[model samples]
Target: MTTPLPEQAKSIIKCCRNGQLAQLKELLSEGIDFQLFDSPLFAPLNTALKHGRWQIVRYLFKENNLPLNKKTPPIIAAAQYSKDNTTGLEIVFAHTGNTEAVDTQDRTALMTAALLGHEKKLTYLIKNATNVNATDHSGMSAFLDAVVNQSLKNCDTLLKNGADPHQITAQGDNAMTLLLQNSTPNPRLIKKLLQQQLDLNHKNNHGHTSLSISQSKHPKIYKVLQAHIEAEKQMELPIFAPSNPIEVAIQPEKNTIKQRPLNEEKTPTKSYSETADDRSSNQLQDTQSKQLSVELSSWFQAATSGNLGLLNKLKIQGLTVDEVDSKGCTALIHAAGSGNRAVASFLIQNQADIEHRSHNGSTALSSAIISNSKSVVDLLIKKQANPAAIGPGKYPYITLAAAQWNAGIVSILADAGAPVNTLDPSQLNLYHNVMLAAEYYSNIIKAKDTVRVIHHLGLDINQTDKEGNTPLHILCGAHKEKAYNADDSQIANLTHELLKLGALSNLTNKKGFTALQYAKKHHLLNTKGVIYSFMS
Candidate 1:
């Protein structure tokens, strides 16, 4: 690599940053580097165009010959800051047909416009023969972008121009499914797409059809599609007239009119409950026993979202409170995992197990701890959950959780008089737990207090594990920068506390390395010097 003239580079960068087109042109003519600002940090012309300084952008794009694509340029800027009707979009698309110009994400201008909801630009580009179906490297099509933006009109325009309705995105969502999966309601767009004959039955990557996604949120859309499907089937039936078609038509008119008047629509109006009963009867007979269970799963999912009213209604309908799902989780597990105290209390009051374990051998208590649910922890502890229970699956250890510095739950366990010195099934003890915590929490405040707590609880200060490494050895073996700034005063104070608690620090591991040797090599000058200073 060649070294650039520092002063010249500085002046050129300043010109670009300031959008001084005249100065930039003069500097370029004077042999200033044009591509010098190509670092991933910021592209010079990209910054200039982003600020709407078209003059400077033209200088860079035309004279200096800087690459306009592959960086945050005017297009992304317009999408973010420009109003929908602004000319910022026009300037962006002008640079689009340049085969030499590439987008920041290597997407075409059409994709960027659609994805970012630059509707005017998108409309112009698509009309001018910019590919409406262009996909980015991530497989996000222009139509998919419009769907993400919830831009119904833009979607209609693209679809009208032959945007592919069947194109599944990288996430395996076709346009029809993507619209329904949005958390927001887009009924107008759903109606429009249904009118275009896009399949509502098309399943996404998750094996859920558009109808399934809309089932709870947009039931109206579901009804419309279901009706359309039924209508399409009816249309496919043969429409032949009878052999005496004229005679039949003449004979039926009077009787049909007179009978219809006498019957006055005949069928009794069904109440909501009656209609529900009839539907449930048909549903039960169609699929004996399994559909009710699946419906229960849907209710449990609603419970997972903390819909207590829905849970109560389902329970009233005779859905079991203790029903285990496919993953062997109940509403209690979901509530505990989420730390939703209200839902947990509701389940507990309803006699759901507070100590239930899932398929992976994780109990509600374990899930609560992992989720950092302090309230759930308190509740479980109050309900007398066994604090000493260890996960039975692979890597079973109560101490593994301490590595994440899960302070509140650990404090709860410690308060419940659980044995702190309880080793893992592999025989590692609380010191190993503190060491792991310190390694990860080296950057957090009061992290050293954790080590002190372990020591105060009657653990060996220099305890060696099966591999023969002590906590200090592990701390010293960290990255050089980490070792340098590891707050040796904290370690000294911890050592003093250990000594006060009648623990030893001169222990050696299997490889015969002491904390002192490791500290010296890692440039932990403060810690090593303190050790010697204390000894002397």
Candidate 2:
């Protein structure tokens, strides 16, 4: 049994936690034995770490060099904090060489990173975290948590790092079925996972295979699975389905130079990359797009400004209230986002679609909760909006509500029959929708970034696609694993192979940029080096 820490020890820890580095240093200079804590958490190092005092933590590690206790490993503590930076975590790796340290829950830092969708951190940790299949007390691995939370990049990282997605869930579900049970089925991610050779024939404990799970709920993913099965008989990897209104599909032919399991000398494991356009024509299109956005954005201006008279005028002018912008943003969505309760209520009263989804898959309710529009949220729920609707990052409406820190909204959603795991915050583990949605907005921010990947396999490195982008340009701005981009022989061998494939560094795309030029424009400096090294 642990004893209470002495007053002096507690004060030292307090200084560490509160970032009182000056006081901590003074106390340290006075020769205080900092290891007087009765518990691991009370230690100055962990206290500094838990509170994100990276400098103090670094100071202790560098000066005193205290042996780390497993009660809260540096990586695990870093993973726990949503805002922890790479430099803070680097302090740990610089001093110590182990990331496999486990917390009380048997959860490794990688699992916490994956559970929270810390893609960049997870990539760095993957090097030392060889136990990609490590599980928590609840038998949840990083792969399982990634799929359940719809952490696309984390899933890709775990898969690449040798996480066994085939590992059964506590509910006895395979990777495919488990993924279907949670997410809306990202057909792009689905095709990639299936291509990893997951079994479609494998059944869950409920006697349902991936085919059954996807066939009923996700017809697109079902088709993808069917296509894969067919392709298997012909022994070729299946290409993505055509673009649709619902699910975005993958096109593998975009960048397939050739497959060699080689990586760069640096091998920054966190692989994620470049874009170009006709200089004048592209500027003209961007201006037009902005003009069109302004025109469409005015659909909700009347509502947001609380000018019901203007709204009525727009209605009289044949502007349907439900009319959406190019991104499917409706007036109601706009009202909800702006927290204009009056307009939101008015729109709802006049037959606004409560559940209409924007191009990004967010609804009016999602916008409302994110904006802390408690009144609008209550109104939507009372009007019978689907409380269980999955929003951005594939999180539940209640889960998204929880992220806003609105107790009232969370309570309302819970009472509205939200399909959530728990209402009590204490019971909310990594798998809970509440925790899953914690990183929802962060994931969405990364969603817009084209995380380029240097493909291990390719058709012709010099081959030009319809966009006038050669394999090199696609290498500059391609999606690798999730929204994070990977690029040029950050896997060094792929770069050498790219050169052998006759990819001309000087060959320009429609944007009139060569491979090196494209990489420069896209800020793919690593790729620039790779292309430059192989240039004639």
Candidate 3:
């Protein structure tokens, strides 16, 4: 607002702000400089773009070769706000070299597109941007921004394109903690961090432990951490016990041995006192336990590898399909996790437990999501996979998928009548799918484009959460979140879309502030402008 506009640029700004297409055309005909770079906030070209005078934007682009500005780069602005104007953005991109221009928040154009779930711009920027790992003021890279935005594919793209997964935030949040904080800490995502050997032990300011930060909600992830701990524990003992307590190997009575003291002399020996018979018996028991472990372990291997022949042979040999491995993964769970639909179907036909939880509290349904196999997921949901049911049910998996705003699996679950109106552990209802995504959209998003694939329970566009936040209030940052506020630029664009969807602007939230009032209180000029335009 402090940026000054030239007298001629003022007339151009007025024409654009008022949507005066004819006047804007006349002004353009006079060969007046459209390169108003001095005051980016009040630049006539940017003003027209901001007000969404697309007819004027398109006309100007077609008729003139406008010079780019470092402060108010056309490509940056178009990528941030004008999502629908793809053609205009392409034209601007061709003329702009300022892809790395950071906003006041220190987020580059790439970061903004990544955070907004702007698929096209994100893809383009990932390939063209000089530094995908560039951090903002908060030490959050574009890859981190993409994770906060919750686009699994985009996160994958960034990671593959050399984005640093090891980067930590100002609050000491690493990749693992950020994913956990977003409430979508699925094992598949956590696996990537583990594979990179990223830190899971560092505590943020929240006073939570390595796994506690993740809410330790993901049982499979505990195994990732626990597996290492268990390995270290083995080094401390002669032979460590295996994890699966389900199959206890019965052993003959044997003499208990005690550690013997070793002399300090050069010829000292360390030994445990036990009868020869006892040692022999212990060896036999060890052999039996290893055999049992191997037999059970093969079941998981077979399930994961789609070895139908081995599975059928085991079934004929009287091994139950419900037999579990050390990790508590039944054959069905292994099959589902690996997306072996044929094997999953075979196990299910053989009466495999549909909701059987592994030792880590994971299930076939969650495993399917980890595989990203929509077909497997759809098949389980059709067989009555309860998403809200806890006690090792689907709640963890549901929370794992909480931030997947536009995932097709979400729609599949919704279509199958997943109990979305019910609250999850976070006290969020179905729309957390959208709300979680919006949480990272700091000054970004193409409202309808982002929310179009989302399914609302009973089509209640104005339904309130436990916090009494209607979608409008939440979209306008009327919720109780303290870490980040909704971006004013995003709120404006999203406000217009929500209004189109019949969001009630007059409705007050738990704190008694309507979306517009909340915007005004927060000094969200763009949000106010959009609401005012809608009202008018």
Candidate 4:
């Protein structure tokens, strides 16, 4: 009973799905309809969003003037398809001010994000005032969705944001009941719910309370619940209020002693008497400050030298773990930047701030990437540091890693939700950064690995910079540079990777020079031959 999509509409969908922004723009300029929906239940905007094509989505909204207040904003689609890169979701949320909009199923975008276990998307939605307890037609709240999907992080986030733990689903299953039915129940989740005082005696649709269900199916957890209930019943807590204010009578008295003459000899100790509290407090403060200073200095050195034992000792002595150096870099930042995994782990275990940015806007995560420390990067990411955090000069942390030609760091960042298409404040894209990497760093393997990561993230290999120079143009220019120091085989391997990623050989720069033309003009015979083969 459905009609087939027109060929033109299919082309629009194809352009959006493939992230062909230029082609899509050209089609739109020619007066192509932007509102056409295809058989897969997607319009041009939703199609781009569904595929994580962020650039195309931005173009559709910014250039095409797409309305964002529809019953289902494009953000819902973006959140549903969100992967490691949540930049698209962030963008849609920043542009569209409708976090409360629901789809036909009465499901908010937060619910969709929670159901899909997209923690970054869920965090963004909850921060933007998306009702955490808002339910769909089935009365399944975002909190319930998180529990059902076994997204422990999302559950913690929802609960911390004031989601009611006792909210029952349309199926009459509360959080406790659902948690008990999990194939493998998480002890931490049960403890957290109990700590939050979730209703232990609440019943489900089958008239079965959490205690009853646990007694039959989950005996170990049932014991935990029972113990918690008994503790609450037997504990007698007291409420203490502040004592009433007391008025003391103050009698006027004569001068206790005569003032000493200016020229008179005075004893140093007899000049003033210090109270016990004042003397002790002053000595304690001075001693603590001196001790803290010594500990912080030792801790900083220990961090850089990968001395975990000393770090732990300092932490155990009550040193501030997050204390920064003169340059405003935390001890964790120093450990991460110096590639000290052991010290970084010790600091993290001791509760250092992983998301703390330095004076220059650099974070421990960015420092780890810049140092080419994969294990440190993984550790920071595991601790939930902001992978997409921007540093000074408005450059994303991944941009710095990509520019260093550090493929291992790039892979780690990609896994931590760093977007491949991040642009710097200077309008330079990842391709540009990669090209710069190839130019400065003669390590062809590193350049190739960086390119591989960019390709894997679904970024366009043929994307041009502000100068209209494709990555091919930059590579050809690099081949001409004597300082590049890359041999013919290395250049050939780089060329092959770019070609594999669909880099166009015939694309020209702003100077009207194609890659082949640039290579031939530079008198780089080997590079010219490789370009010819790819172009032909």
Model 3 over residues 57-102: C-alpha lDDT tens digits? 7766676544334465566676666462455455556655456667
Tell me the whole-model lDDT of each prediction, alpha carbons only. 0.59, 0.60, 0.62, 0.70
- Model 1 regions more than 4 Å off: 1-147, 150-168, 171-300, 392-401, 441-443, 478-505, 520-536
What tens-digit string does per-residue lDDT give for candidate 2 at 25-44? 87767665545533564567
| Candidate with the larger lDDT of 1 and 4 | 4
Ranking by lDDT: 4, 3, 2, 1
Cα miss at 121, model 1 (Å)? 28
Candidate 4 per-residue C-alpha lDDT over 1-536 given as tens digits, one digit per residue, 9 for 90 to 100:
65677777677779999999888777666664444432444477887877888888877777755434345667787877858457777777677766767788888878888888889888888866535688888888998888777787898777656576678888888888888887788888787666456788888778988899899998888888987764343111010111221111111111111111223354356223556765786678766554454456666656765778877787788667887765567788878866888888878887888888766566777667665678888888888888887754456777777776777877787787888888865566777667744533456777788888788888888887677777787777622433334455566668778887788888777778888776665665787787788777
Per lDDT, the best of the predicted structures is: 4
Count of clashing residue pairs in every prediction: 0, 23, 0, 0
Clashes of 3: 0
List the candidate 3 regions with Cα displacement exceeding 4 Å: 1-277, 294-319, 325-327, 358-362, 369-372, 384-403, 425-427, 440-457, 485-495, 517-529
